[model samples]
Target: MTLYARYSELLDTVLDTLQADGTLPDGIERRAVAVEPPRDPAHGDLATNAAMVLAKQARTNPRALAEAIAPGLEALPDVSSVEIAGPGFINLRLTDDAWRGELATILREGDSYGRSDAGGNERVNIEYVSANPTGPLHLGHCRGAVVGDALARVLEAAGFRVTKEYYVNDAGGQVDTLARSVHLRYREALGADIGEIPEGMYPGDYLVPIGTSLAAEFGDEYAEAPESEWLELFRTRAVAAMLDFIRHDLATLGIHHDVFASEAALQAEGAVDAGLERLRSKGLIYEGVLEAPKGQTPEDWEPVELTLFKSTEFGDDQDRPMKKSDGSWTYFGSDAAYHLRKAESADHLVNIWGADHAGTVKRVQSAVKALTDGRVDLDVKLVQMVRLFRAGEPVKMSKRGGTFVTLADMVEEVGKDVVRFIMLTRRADAPLDFDFAKVVEASKDNPVFYVQYAHARVRSLVRKAADAGVSLDAPADLSLLDAEELALVKLAAQYPRTVESAAMAHEPHRIAFYLYDLAAAFHALWNRGNDDPGRRFLVDDNPELSRARLELALGIGQIIRSGLDLMGVEAAEEMR
Candidate 1:
């Protein structure tokens, strides 16, 4: 358990004592009680709102309830003093030994320091980066990929059984266009002058290899055949080839999904029909003409009867369609079915989609809730776009990607670690500016370099300590650490809570924000030695103090490595 968790348990015991002695009421819910660091460090090490939240239930004012709880808290061995400030908030200053014990725990746990079982091994299925197979993954898909993958890592660290998934939209109209585009390329490969790529086809040259392979395999058998003879065959081959291309690009950035569910396979096996039938049995599906979109008159709109799902009953703005007038499933219908299939195996479902899909979130969420009879919940995280720049100038589109900068392009230029770390520097729903010159720059403004440099400095301290004959292998007397050094331990000890909170909120960007603050504190300590030689991590006269300081530095480095591992970034040991 972490220092904070240990104290939280103690606070619970104190509350229990109050109830046992008839000072407070019995059977009151204590779930609202929280023990955390005070807003201001000067207030105290820890503060709790047990009185503030329980005052009403206790039939007393907050101050009166606080008066009853203070003595119980003061009796704890680790607490040196307890003060009630402003509106009956109870703050406690822990003994220095308490902080020292936490530092020792950091060294003892090492890489496993921040890991926890807060998730209780619940099954969570996260589907992300399900880009269409028509082209390479662009910058729009990159942000969602990083956010989803990092979230998976964080959830696993918090003890959830996570399944990383990718949904292939191979059964869509775009893949048909892809087949036509590849057929044109195949004709060009067969010594035919197909001229420039037409207006409606994929214009990138990435498909040239797939066409060439088809020409080399089948010769001219399908070259002169009609579209009916080879459209499905070519679409199958083209989508498979594009999936391979996508997998290679995703692997470059260290992303690999555990499950790749195919929309085409789902439809081929009649899952969509089965899912719709289940909804029909629940009275959520029916053949009805949707009213004209809001703000339009009935005379101006042509309404057609279609198979619709009662999405509005479950909180959606309007009912959603399951099939078109032509009796084919709409995109939302297929997606809803896919979610139903996923929910059958997992306890919870999460979708990471681009911001462009924000309008569809409510409908899909309602579909999941209705389909599962309120048994499962769906969380949709919408990722904003990433704009690329080169030295402050807007970057031109990639020729290979046809319109946008490809994921492979970004990963190849700035490296995988830099790409992963910088992508998360902002919230996933906020626009991010990525400059080639800025991300690779070795400056404090760059979080990737700043965090990595802190870890590298810790490693450099070890090498310097070895050369100066300062032994670090001996047991560290943590009591030798002063207030300045112990302050760092206080910051590093929040890692466990940080992981648990970030995982619970489904916000992986919190880890990035926390790492930057921790690194800043460490750098401030490293810079302190420049003014006084005695403050240096390696003391020429007092080797014992030097070893204790080294222990502090190593503990910080261990935390940095663990956070970077969760982000899928490497901790640099040395800088060039």
Candidate 2:
């Protein structure tokens, strides 16, 4: 167990003892009590607000309650001291043996050091990068892909049964455009002069190979077929090819999905109609005319009666229409059916979308709530825009002009590790600037390089110890470690808590930030040796001390590796 968890368990034991002795009231809810790292390290190793939380309920003075609880915590085996501070907070300083035991646990657990059961084996479905099956994935789709994939890994480490999912929007009008583009290419391949891909058709050269494959399969067979006869055939082939291209792009960035749910297949199976009927049976669906949107009204806007869902009853700003004026199902209708199908099996649903879809979140959430009857919970994370730069100048990319930077392009320019790590330097809701010049620099400004450098430095230390014949089999004399060394261990000890918190919050960026902090701590210790020879890991006259220090270094390396694995990043053994 992590030291923080151990301390929390001790605090709980104290609370139980207080209640049993009648000093505290029985059945006092302890859920709000938190044992966490103190805001100021000078205060203590850990701090708790148990006294403040229970004082009112127990009908006692806050500081007096803290004073009463302090003795019980101070008497615990692992706690070295406990002090009651301002406003009923209790600060704790743990024994050196406690930090040593945590290091031993780290060496024993290795890559599984931070794994936890906080999720309690709940099933979570994460759906992301559901881009339209039109062309190659562009910069717009990159952040959500990386964020969703990393969050899945984080939740898995926190003991959730996670399913990584991708939704294929193949039933949309964009796919029809893809089919037409492919047909144009097919005609061009058959010696027909299909002029400059007329406006509104995909013009990326990535489709040239698909056109060649089509020509090879049926010589002029589809070249002459009318629109009705060839639309479905071309649509099927185009979507399949685009999905393969998308899969390859995702592979380059080290992303894989367990399920790829198809909107077209759901619509084909009458799932949308059945879902609507279920809502209709519950009187949640009605035919109504919606008011004009509040902002600038479209010139073509006109009131029309359509099938609407009673989304406003569930906190949406207004009732949402489920069908278009032409009587065809809308995108929200298809997504509602898709979510209903997902909610049937999963206890939790998470969708990662771009910020452009922010306005649709409430209606989609309302739809899921109505469909599932509050049985399953849904969370939608919106990833903001990413602007790519080389040096300081902006990299202009556009999918319409066929000049957009694709995911494959970025991965090729920089390595997959660089792409993944830099994408997570900021939170999902914050705009990120990926500068080619800065991310590759060997400086602290480049988080990936800084963290990887720390890992590589530890590996180098281990090799030096091995070369000097330092025996690692001996148990470490952790008591010899001073304040600086213990500070490093304290930072490493926060890994499990960070994992649990990041997983619960559905934010994978926290793991990235934690790893960077750990790397900084490790680097600080390494740099300290330069000024004080005794602080160095290698000592000519004291092999025992050298071995102990090496053990500490190895434990830190283990944490870096574990945290990197959670982010789907590689821990480098050597820097290039």
Candidate 3:
């Protein structure tokens, strides 16, 4: 168990004892009491607000309660001293043996050091990077992909059964556009002189290969077919080809979704109709005309009575239309059915979308609530834009020319690990600037490089110890570790708490930040050894101390490796 968990258990024991002795009231809720590290390490190694929180309920003075609990806390095996501070805060200083035992646990658990059962095996579905099947993925989709994939890994490490998912928007008009573009390429491949692509058509060269495949398969068979006879056939072929291209691009970043729910399939199976019927029974579905949007009404806007969902009843700003004027289901209707299908089996649903979709968040959440009768929880995380830069200059974009930088282009420029790490350097809702020159630099400014370098430095130390005939596998006398050395171990011991908090908050960026802090702590300790030879890991006259310091270094490395694994990053044994 982690030192923090041990301390928490001890605090619980103290509270139980106090209650049994009739000094505190019975049935006091202990869930809000937290035992954690002090914000200022100068105070103590650990601090708790148990007395402050429970005193009010127990009808006693907080300081008196803290004073009453101090003796019992100081008597605990691991605690060296306990002090009552301002108000009712209790500060604890643990023994050297406590730090040593944590290091031993790290060496024993290895890569599983931070694994926890905080999630309790609940099933979670994470949907992200559901980019349209029209072309290769672009810079906009990259952040959500990395964030979702890393969150899945983190949740799984916290013992949650996670399913990575993607929603294929093949029923949209974009696939038809893709089919027409492929047909243009098909005609060009057959010796027809098709000039520059007409306006409103996809002009990307990625479609050339799909066209070539079509030409080879049926040599002009589709050349003379009517639009009705060939539209569905071409749409099917184009969507499949685009999905293949997308899968390959995702593979480059080490992302593979466990499920690909198709919007077209949901529509064809009448799931949308069934879902609407269910909402209709709840009086959430009705035919109504919506008022013009307040801020920017369309120039040709006209009132039309259409099928609408009572989204306002469930916290949306207004009732949302479910059908278009042409009697076809709107995109919102399709999405509602898709979420209903998702809520059927998963205990929790999470969708990672771009920030531009912020306006749609409320309506979809409302739809899911109506569909599930509030039985399921849905969380939508909006990832902000990512701007690309090279040498501090913004990368250009040309929407008319279809010349945005694709995900494939970025992956080819930097390695997959670098791309994944840099994409998560900021929170999902914050805009990130991915500078080509800065991310690849081997300096403290680059987080991934700094963290990896720390792990490699520890590995280098182990190699040096082994070269001098030191046995790292043997147990060490951990009491030889002084304040600076023990401080490093304390930072390493926070891994379990970090993992649990990050998983519960659905924030994978926390893991990245924690790893960087750990690396900084390790680097600081290594620098300290430069002026003080006695503090160094290699001591000529004291091999026992040297072996113990090596164990501390190895334990630090184990934690770094475990944290990196959660982020799906590879820990380097040596820097290039």
Give the whole-model CA lDDT for all candidates, comma-separated. Answer: 0.92, 0.91, 0.91
383-482 per-residue lDDT for model 2 (tens digits): 9999989999999877778998999998998889998998888999999999988988999989999999999998999888888988777687877777
Per-model TM values vs. the true structure: 0.98, 0.98, 0.97
- Tens-place lDDT per residue, model 1, 1-576, is 767778889999999998999878999888889888898999999999999999999999999999999998999988999999988899999899988888888989988899988889999999999999999988889899999999999999998999999999999899999999999889889999998888889989899999999999999999889999999999999999999999999999899999999999999999999989989999999889997877758675788999999999999988999998898999999998999999998988989999999999999999999889988899999999898899999988854348777899899988999999998999999999999999988999999999999999999999999998988677978798989999998999889989999898899999999999999999999998999999988889988999999999999999999999999999999977
> lDDT (0-100) at residue 336 of candidate 2?
92
lDDT of 3 by residue, 1-576 (tens): 567777889888988899999988999988889989899999999999999998999999999999988988999998899999999999999888888898999999887888888889999999999999998899889899999999999999888999899999999888888888889888888878889999988998998998889998878987767777777888899999999999999999999999998999999999999999999999889999999878999899889999999999999999998889998889999999999999998889999999999999999999999999998889999999999899999999885688899888889998888989988899999999999999999999999899999999989998888888888666788988898899999899999989888888899999999999999999988887799988788776789999999999899899988888888788899998
By lDDT, the better pick of 1 and 3 is 1
The local lDDT score (0 to 100) that residue 17 gets in candidate 2 is 93
For model 1, the superposed segments whose C-alpha errors exceed 4 Å read 296-300, 398-403
Higher-TM-score candidate among 1 and 3? 1
**Candidate 2, TM-score vs. the true structure?**
0.98
Worst 10 residues of 3 by lDDT: 222-231
